[model samples]
Target: MSKKDSAKATLNDLNGKEWVKATKSWFVVNPKPRSAGQANHPAKYPEELVSRFLRFFTKADAWVLDPFAGVGSTLVAAKELGRNAIGVELNGEYVEIGSRHLEKTKGSGRTYLIMGNAHGTLEHLGEIFKDSIPPFSLLMTSPPYWNMLRKSRGGNDSVQKEREASGFDTYYSDSEEDIGNLDDYAEYIDTIGEIFDRLEPILAKNAYLVIVVQNMRDIDGEMKPIAWDLARRLSKTYALRQEMIWCQDNKRLGCWGYPTTYVSNVHHHHCLILQKR
Candidate 1:
């Protein structure tokens, strides 16, 4: 074999073709049907999404962190991929469900799903992890989109109505600790930045963070550029690397505004990629 082919991959286990394919700026992934426990969470990103990044950013047996791990998607993905994972969730119910999933996960590495606020968990990492915390090579999470879930779109919002009818949570918990519950957009952005800032000590140098977020239209009909805003905010701390667009072609088109306005049915999210500087 040539010297280039014989060389081992340092970033991940992928070969040349796989690595090149993953570098595409945009991709589509129609989520698989969620398990019952997974469906209960309003805003849970798919494990496939997590696995894709995991395969690209880290090699086997690396440590991964998810500050807003809803129902342990990140943990389960990490376990399956042979990576130890630590997830911090604020809701006890979610923690319980996530723990059950983690217990059944058959894999080489360990998984820890802690029930606490993200900031608090970081602050007390030593006590929480029994003083043996691992430096995370990847921090992938889908935080609340600035309380957008809490905003009611009135009678025309069919998705929210269906969630209500099915006894699923329409929004994250009403906990004051959840930054998603904050009313002010500016404050919410700052809190999100602070959480990532707090992760600096534990994140390995050049560790990658994949934050999934979306731009949304507010109730007042103003555009809230959440994805861009967060990128700008966090770039001051972490090195802003690149963004991959996650598109969904399976969602039904909603006629949000009839004849007068041009409200779009958004079916995409921004996966902001950042590196620990």
Candidate 2:
């Protein structure tokens, strides 16, 4: 067979699989507990979760980027999958910790962890990438659930008590620049949207962007539809594609509003998938 025929055959083989398996609206994942290095971050998505998305959206040697790289989970997954990755993290502490994790990953793919605010660092992407920014094939990240961490106070609840005993601060950072510390919900969402807008120029055409977020109750017990609002805002730049619900069934049920009001123990997250238009 000719070389062209071989290439066509390979394409056919890739398309023959049931790619629709990923289209399922929801997934039940039992993520393993965080490793000691990742324990410092209040919120760290499982590397397995990032790996699954990376396999679906990208191929070997393709570029992957994470603007809000908490502990470099995305970068670690990318390297393991043989994809080069760049991560922008705000906290210096997290950058240091995540850098150590990256060094331990045994893979051929390259990884870069930039220690700076995502918003500021985005402007210098080309410089960071050595004079010209490469188009990223995939963007997968989870932002801070706006201000929820700050509101979490140690209580008699076993989970809260355990976290408090561990001496881990509930919030991501004390920095005023941290989006999780923002008190104004509208401003916080707008700020996040703006970051995506800035990223639009750097993203490759038709590339997929996945944002993992969850709705949460505010300090006043009001439900803040963060997931929905962000989707709507980001639709201005990228096409709003489907959403996959990430369900976690392992969490112990907590009686939030016992007999008083209807409050759900939210066990699912909105995995909003967007494509560059």
Candidate 3:
């Protein structure tokens, strides 16, 4: 028998060429323009981004989960790729917008967007699935980047000002239960860790999780390595496979602390890929 005929592709549906291409440690994805309803979400990552990971991580008809579903980007992406998806979102407005978008998504796979905190949402999956919740083969999400959105960058070129002027939300939500609203950084990291740790029961063995996150500069000029911190925290629960850098070349550059101190225009996010043990 020929090697090509005998070799099996187990992780995903990608062929040899596609599999090799996806193995690269970094990728570039500039977000597409958002719709009016989608623009209401302060931190809505693109569906295209989610679609790329979905294609590389899961096969057709595989179940996917997104715990931090903002406007149902992950859910929509999963459906488009013929993968069943379940999303847990906190904000009601975002959930409504996500549901509207999900309705228009045309695909063979089913999708459900539950409006509730991700921390406790998994417990109620039995009520929705009737028999038992399917073990998710892949989990891809970009959770809140701490409370950085609420911190004023103190510049006229700040995107927060433009968002506020355009009547859009500047942060995820004002709810006390929101992870992005937490003030204490250590507690915030711990909470996120706990959330993922709880998913052990629902995740299929060897299921891959791709978390899109980034390091940030605090208002006081302190560098917060959020991406690394999260990787370290989650490593205890899930096997830390590797990190893929998601770079964006389309974002406009801002002179953050120019002429006095060096400040880079960070246009990349860390895609930490982990596997269920």
Indicate which candidate wins on TM-score: 3
Error of 3 at 130 (Å): 3.9
> 274, model 3: CA deviation in Å?
0.3
Please provide TM-scores, in order, for all candidate models, with all chains considered together: 0.95, 0.92, 0.95
Steric collisions counted per model = 0, 0, 0
Arranged by TM-score, best first: 3, 1, 2
Q: Clashing residue pairs in candidate 3, if any? A: none
Error of 1 at 158 (Å): 1.3
lDDT of the candidates, in the order given: 0.89, 0.84, 0.89
RMSD of 2: 2.8
Model 1: how far residue 112 lies from native, Å = 0.4
The window of 10 residues in a row where model 3 has the poorest summed lDDT is 1-10
Writing each residue's lDDT as its tens digit, candidate 1 over 191-274 gives: 999988888888987899999999989999999999999999999899999999999999878777788888888999999999
Relative to the unseen true structure, what is the C-alpha lDDT of residue 177 in candidate 1, on a scale of 0 to 100? 94
Writing each residue's lDDT as its tens digit, candidate 3 over 119-154 gives 986675867986688989999999999998888774
